[model samples]
Target: MGLRLLIIVALFLVVEIYAYQAVRTLFKPKWLLISYALISLFLLVYIVYSFMQFDRAVGQTQHTMFVMGLMLLVYLPKIVITVILLGEDVFRLGASLVNYLMYNLPKNELMPERRKFVSQLALGLAAVPFLSLLYGIFEGKYNFKVIKQTVFFPDLPDAFDGFKITQISDVHSGSFDNHEKINYAIDLINDQETDMILFTGDIVNTHATEMHPWLNTFNRIKKYKYGKFAVLGNHDYGEYVTWPSQKAKDDNFKGIKNLYGQIGFDLLLNEHRFIEKDGQKLALVGVENWGKNFKQAGDLNKAALGVNQNDFKILMSHDPSHWEYEIKEHPKNFHLTFSGHTHGMQFGIEIPGVFKWSVAEYIYKQWAGLYENKGRYVYVNRGFGYHAYPGRVGIMPEITVIELKKGSNVG
Candidate 1:
């Protein structure tokens, strides 16, 4: 922590000296000196918090603490914006970055080797913010994806083979301030050649009407022989946002569930339905939002309790962890499970048979994609929406088209 503090201090000193010199070159005001000192103080706190929490584990509760400490600096921006709006809005890191790129960058006095190193780091760091926005564009439309695993049920007849089920998770439609980008996303989903469309969870950021505008696009999406289906996600229930009364919140929740029906989706709540073709059956079971410290994962045990042991089953529960810890170990094994709450966080590496490590792994081993044990398969689709972070990085949104096939009893 001490070493990290030193590094932070050193970086701040370098940037401050450069900034002061640039400001003082023309004329230095006493207020400017005071402002710089305050900014330095804020940096001191931010850097110290970041350093102390730098080594915290991502899976444990400490992980959220780490993120909260870093975001402490982020919240100051809105306060700073309202109180002090002029001369680059120091708290708005984006503004400072633009200024640094456009001006102070050319003024570095370091040696050639040192100069190039700093230049590269500066450019790379600056890229993360813009790259986040680009992530939003691609993620909203479910582009740049990796297929985790394609599961096949041998019990399924040839008639249902190659039946592609498109899965979308975390739409967070209320987050769409950019209509064009959202429309593009809707167009992309509507254009897919999918048989069945399943929305695992999280249809809106809050209000049910938030999804009304997207209906035209969602309507265009080709439904399967079984039709479109959805289960509630943590967000869809409006727990994150506040209402004047519990009744209001419950009303909103029911409204969104009704919206799902209007959009041609059967909102599943701890229920099961069989998809039939050619005298064969594949039971698809869905549960309402539920999990540890998350939504009520609903009851997979009850949802599947009625299914015949011999019939193949597909379970759609939002959080992937449910599959890892609960369903996989259950007595009545599920042939395939589909989940999408992770969104791969809209960032990470999904290279097939390659390395996979991200914060999501800390909480959900089945974070994004397919994991199998025995004959049971869990396919965690990279989601189709963005959330609080507001943009994706390496992980793009996904429109999962899972084509279940028939495999031999032996591997």
Candidate 2:
């Protein structure tokens, strides 16, 4: 903790210095300087106060929201200024070296002071991201988008051809601040009107009480013909918080599972349920939370107990890493897998076919959208809600509608 604080302070000082240089270079008026100083001092105080109260504020949605806004609006702009200025310094150093080598310039004459235009340019570039983040907080956070995809499978049952499944994941209810916006999101899911609904976990951040407030809103979600099913994510296990006793923790877990029931979802814990249509059965398997570094309570084999080897199977696992590490090459040959833990890091550039990238891609091989290997498939939902970051940027919250088509060459 001490080391982390030192690093944060050091970074803050560097960023502020760069910000000061940029502002001072552009404007020399005493009034302007005084205004800048006061703004900087207030931001610095807020940053320190946020850090000092982090432990107490983290669990409180409103407090954390304020801190996150400060980070995006103030701290992020300073960091961007620092990066732009650092890049400018690198070019300046190269210019100095070139002057010495080519013209045999004296030490005093070799290097010139940073250009005022360079500082102006740095500040200008930094404003782009700062303004974008501000917009993200206000609008992008609630910008729920529906991503439609079609996956073809040779082994898919003809009776279930063109079966539409709506998927949502990572509803960290603890972090939600707006009830009306959440209700709007739920209404959007109902608008899809898919045959089945799959929730790939993280219903709450840590405890069951977080979900109590949203119960009525979620319970109003329109029922699907095939039914709604869900699996636990790492956050659902209450492992991130301290408990007074083991029984208290157990009680919390029970409440979380019961909340799913209240919301009209069948909670699957290493279990399999058959969704039948026209006398043809497609197995839906769901396993508990399992990730490379997170909780690994999920048992795929147990979930597949009654499922046949050739049955058209859909597995609901929280983390995409589970598909990367276990499910993709498993003997069972799950036709389609749904996951939602990535949330695309809630920030990234995703322009369909043109470009798709996120910091989460480095961590989870199958971070978001559809991934195929041989004949198997997995659709990773970006998530239904935001988490620690409070708001999303380029990667908006997602509601995935997958239409499963039978046979090849069917576009």
Candidate 3:
């Protein structure tokens, strides 16, 4: 880890130096150049210091946000500059070859000096992402968007027709910095007034204590007629942090389970529950965290123990990979599944019906939105809160409302 950190720092320094040189060439004033250098140096030093203190300060929301904000303000812009500089170097190399072959020029005079216009252009282009990132930090993170979808099932009970279910995932309450913003988000969820609510894991980041500060605020979520249900996501298992002893870790897990209860959630651990209306029932099955590369404690068969294969079943699993690897292929067909572990990588462009894409797509096939395979469906929520990056980019936080219908319309 130390060696990897050194390599990252060295690479960042190289980019910083290149960016500094570009600024120096653009502005010939010594004072301006010195000022830019000092600012860059300070940010770089702070980044290193933040890395060194990460373990100790990881629980501090302000400290984490500060370090992440610095990276966005300084490092990202420099990376853009580096890309532009590298492109110019490629042009220079080509020009040098042409001069050597045609004019027999010396290596020193083969290529022209770096263009001031190029530096200016690079700076202009770099501002685009820097500004976008700033917007993400200030506005985009709290830009909660409600996505509604209607799923049609031929065998869906008539009583469940038009039954609305609100789903939110990956709260990661440990990373929250503002109470008002969170309260507003919770209010938005309640505004949906869905019949039932389903949370697909990740209430906190690492430890159970992370949810202590926001317990009351989240507990204020309006009650659903069918009640709210939740399942464990990989992060909720207390596996990321080192505990003093095995008992401490077990206690932390217990506390997390208790927190869900305090929030009025029926926390399911490889279990199934029934939501009935007018003598018609649908099975709501929830399992522990299961993923390709993450923890696989979730047992589908165990969770489906009492669930009838013929009944319309909605499975709640944290990772979408579980749906593809296990749920989809399981002998018993599931009408729908809900998941949100990817969080769309908390970044990406998603224009409904036009185009939806994110870096997370490469990692998880069903990263976001709805996907269907042989009548089995899955909807991966984009998440309700931000995490490690401290802010979202193109992808904003999500609140998903799904209404189940009894029949399909092919038109």
Candidate 4:
């Protein structure tokens, strides 16, 4: 996760840096210098803290310093955004221009005469935490989103036109302390005129014991016709948390699987199930964590057992890389696959044309939207819940409704 975060922050800094460069000519480079210096300081602290976070055995010295460092960076955006919007839109805009400069260039002690900028820098840094707190408010309610694509197979019958499949992925159950906030998300999904509901992995975090409290919240989900199904994410097994005995870990996996069953979902561990209506069967194959970086234990060949290759198939794998690395080149092409590991770096622009260039581009070409490989379709969901960061800036929580239309050509 450290490497993942490093990649994400690096991506964010790249955009922020370039955005700063665009406005450099407009602001005093000295102000730009100070503002830039502030950003570098934050980034340096962030990098140090990040390293501290990744090194578990580094004792509290590095951990404490690192965490304290990250605590400030997390709030810097709020400060930047707030300062840019103060009193009037223009003044705030000016602040924003300055803030970008600060983030791009860390200007300190370079010039003896530029001492007046220190007050603005200090003031800006002071608002970081408050800005982050304000940013949290943006996540309180339902946000309208654009579903990038609707996949279709030639054999799909007309009965399933605009078939809405609400997909939620990366719900790290252990991360949630408040059930009401979770219910809000669930209510959002239930209220949608969705056809079937599918959760693509990470149903629970670690031991099954961590999931007992939130069963009621997840069970509140309601919708139109088809039932619910899910597969295992990388965190499903309790690997991060140490157990007294290996048996404890084994029992945790068992309990988590039972919890999945309890939540009214079919835990598809490298297996296929058919969702049929009006005598037309649509094959849905789900495999346990088949990511390029995470776990590669699931077998797509076994998942497709007894299911004919000619049938219209929709696969549910966790990460987008799986589709790129495995499914797209499989012997039998899956018409559509739903995945949600990207969460869109949880905070990058995903507006189709431009979203492709973001950091997510370097990793998964089809990070948080839809892509077609050869002729097959894959939808990378933007996740239902947030993780370690606890907030989303660009790629919001997604409630996907896939509309499947019958195609005349089945070849």
Candidate 5:
């Protein structure tokens, strides 16, 4: 592990060196250059020290989050500069090789001087992410976008033809620093006035106490006619931290489950509830966090015990990977599944309808938005809050409002 860490640090230093070449080419003042290097060195040392000080028992905290934000803000742009400058080096190497082979140039003078325009271009490109990350930390995390999606199900219960369900997932309440913004987001959800509200969870980072301050804030969410419901997320299980004992972990898990009820939500734990409208019943089945890479505590069969395969069902599971790996192919034939956990990797370019891309796409097939497989659909909410990085980039936080329609075609 020590060797691996050393290798990673070495690579990080190499990227910094390559990135600095861009700055050196563009600037000539020695004092200014020395100041930049000193600042970079200080940040690198502090970041490494902070990471080394991280306590697994304590898990994520404001201090750690700040360090993570700093690490990303410092390195991501540098990586961009590194890649660009490295490409220039490759080209320069080829030119030097040709000069040596064809013109018999001396080895000492074989390589040509680096182009100023190339450095300028690299720095210009690097500025994009640097500014974006800064904006993300200060504002984008709270940039809540209401995404309305109307899904058509041929077998949708007739009485619930135009049912509107608002979903907010991956709350990660522990990471919230602005109550005013959260209240505004809550108001936005209330303004929708959807028939039902579903939260596919991560109510806290690792400890239930992380959500205590936000209790009344979240409690402000008005009750929906059909009711508000939620299911446990992987984080709610407190799996990320090292517990003193299993009982302590169990106690925290119990507290996390109670947080939903405190917020006026009926916490569903491998259970199902039927919402009846005009003599027609639609099944709402919820399972505990069942992630392909995380936990497998959710029991789908147990949750859907009373509901038949033909029943119109909407399943709420925390991780989208659950739907992709197991539920999608399950015989239960859930009409729709709501999930969050990917958070669109909290970074990616998403141009609605025209183009969408995230690093998360490589991991989960249904990373964001609505995805369908043989009439069964899953809508993955980008997230309601930010986590590790403490901010969002291109993919803004989401409040997904889905309307259920009875038809073969989706609008």
Candidate 6:
């Protein structure tokens, strides 16, 4: 552990040195440089100290969230600077080596001076993320977007063809700091007037008590006509934090489950419910938190027990990996699945349909929006709240409204 920590610190210093070169070249005044170095050092010490003080039992308090946010805000832009400067150094080195071979240059002439223009360009480019991250911390986390998607399924029941469902996932109520913003988001959900609403997990960061203050706010979600339902996500299990006792952990788990009920949602735990419309019924199967890398508590087979193989089913599973690894290939065909765990990494570039990219794509194939596999579809919500990072970048908080269409999509 000590050696690993040393290596990490060493690498961090290397990045700082490269990043500093850009600042040093851009700003010539000694006092200004000294001030920049001192500020950077202070941030480094504070971040390291706060992380060392992390309490597993307490878990995800506001102080820790603030630290996490500060760390990202301070370093992500620096990383961009470091990368650009490092690449320039590599080019300079190659040019120097060639010059030395051709002209027999002195040792002092092995490398040329850093270009002011390059440094200026690096700083200018870095400003994009720096300012963007700052805005994310203050405003983007609550920048709710109502994304509407219409999916066509041949197997969809005629009566339910035009049914609309609103999905909001990964609430992470524990991290909410502004009631006004949350209230506005809730109102946005209610405004949609969808036939049904579904919440796909991570109701709290770890402790269920984190949601105590927002029970009433969530309960104001206004009941939907076909009913509101939800399923658990990985974080809802309270497994990330250490517990004082097994009973304590169990009690928190129970409280978390009850939170859904408090908000008037039928919390489905490896269960199935039928939503009927005009004599035709559609199965809504929900499973507990199931992830390819996290827990595997969701029992899809058991959840769909009574539902027929021919019945049109909509599944609610917290992690999209459940669909990727198992649900997509299951014998009991699920026409549609709802999931939200990646949160688009709370950072990325997204432009309606023209372009979309995120770090989350490397981890989750169905990270943000809708995906299809041989007619079966999965819509992964980009989360309705922020967690560890305490903010969101390009991927804003989402309120997904999905319309069910009976016929093939028109191209």
Worst 10 residues of 5 by lDDT: 14-23
Q: Write the per-residue lDDT of candidate 2 for residues 76-171, one digit (tens) a residue.
A: 777888888888889889999999999899999888787898888888888887877887778888899999998898888999988999999999
- Report the Cα lDDT for candidate 5: 0.94
Which stretches of model 2 miss by more than 4 angstroms? 56-60, 94-110
Local error of candidate 3 at residue 60 (angstroms)? 6.7
- Whichever of 3 and 6 has more lDDT, that candidate is 6
Tell how far residue 17 is off in model 1, in angstroms: 10
C-alpha lDDT (0 to 100) for residue 407 of candidate 1: 67
Superpose all Cα atoms of candidate 6 onto the true structure and report the RMSD in Å to 1 decimal.
1.1
Per-prediction count of colliding residue pairs?
Answer: 8, 0, 0, 11, 0, 0
TM-score of 3: 0.96
- The total number of steric clashes, by the backbone 3 Å criterion, in model 1 comes to 8
Greater lDDT among 1 and 4 belongs to 4
Tell me, by lDDT, which candidate is best: 5
TM-score of each: 0.69, 0.94, 0.96, 0.70, 0.99, 0.98
TM-score of 6: 0.98
In model 1, the worst 10-residue window by lDDT is 109-118
Q: Candidate 6: list runs displaced more than 4 Å.
A: none
Off by over 4 Å in 1: 1-149, 350-355, 408-411
Q: What is the lDDT of residue 29 in candidate 6?
A: 97
- lDDT by residue (tens digit), candidate 3, 286-351: 999999999999999999998887988999999999999998878889889999989898778877
Give the Å error, residue 108, model 6.
1.9
Minimal lDDT window, size 10, model 6: 402-411
Per-residue accuracy of model 6 over 1-411 as CA lDDT, tens digit each:
789878877877787887789999988899999999999899888988898899998999999999999988888888888889988999999989987999888989879889999898888888998899899999999999999999998878999988999999999999999999999999999999689999999999999999999999998999899999999999999999999999999999999999999999999999999999999999999999889999999999899999998999999999999999998988888999999999999999999988999999999889999999988999999999999988899999999999999988721
lDDT of 1 by residue, 27-104 (tens): 458898778668766865765565465431121123333344344333322222222222233434564466576666
Off by over 4 Å in 4: 1-149, 351-358, 407-411
Query: Compared with the true structure, what per-residue lDDT tens digits does model 4 show for residues 1-411?
Result: 779878866755554553343334336658776787587667656665665456332222324433543654443553453344232345545655676666553344222232234435544555654454345324521243535345666667566666778888887676565666677778777777777888888766565765688888877776347788888877776666557788877887889888878888889999999888877777889988877878787789999998887887889998878888889888888888889877676555555465344466777777877777667888888877655555565567777877776663322
State the C-alpha lDDT per candidate: 0.67, 0.88, 0.89, 0.68, 0.94, 0.93
Better of 2 and 5 by TM-score: 5
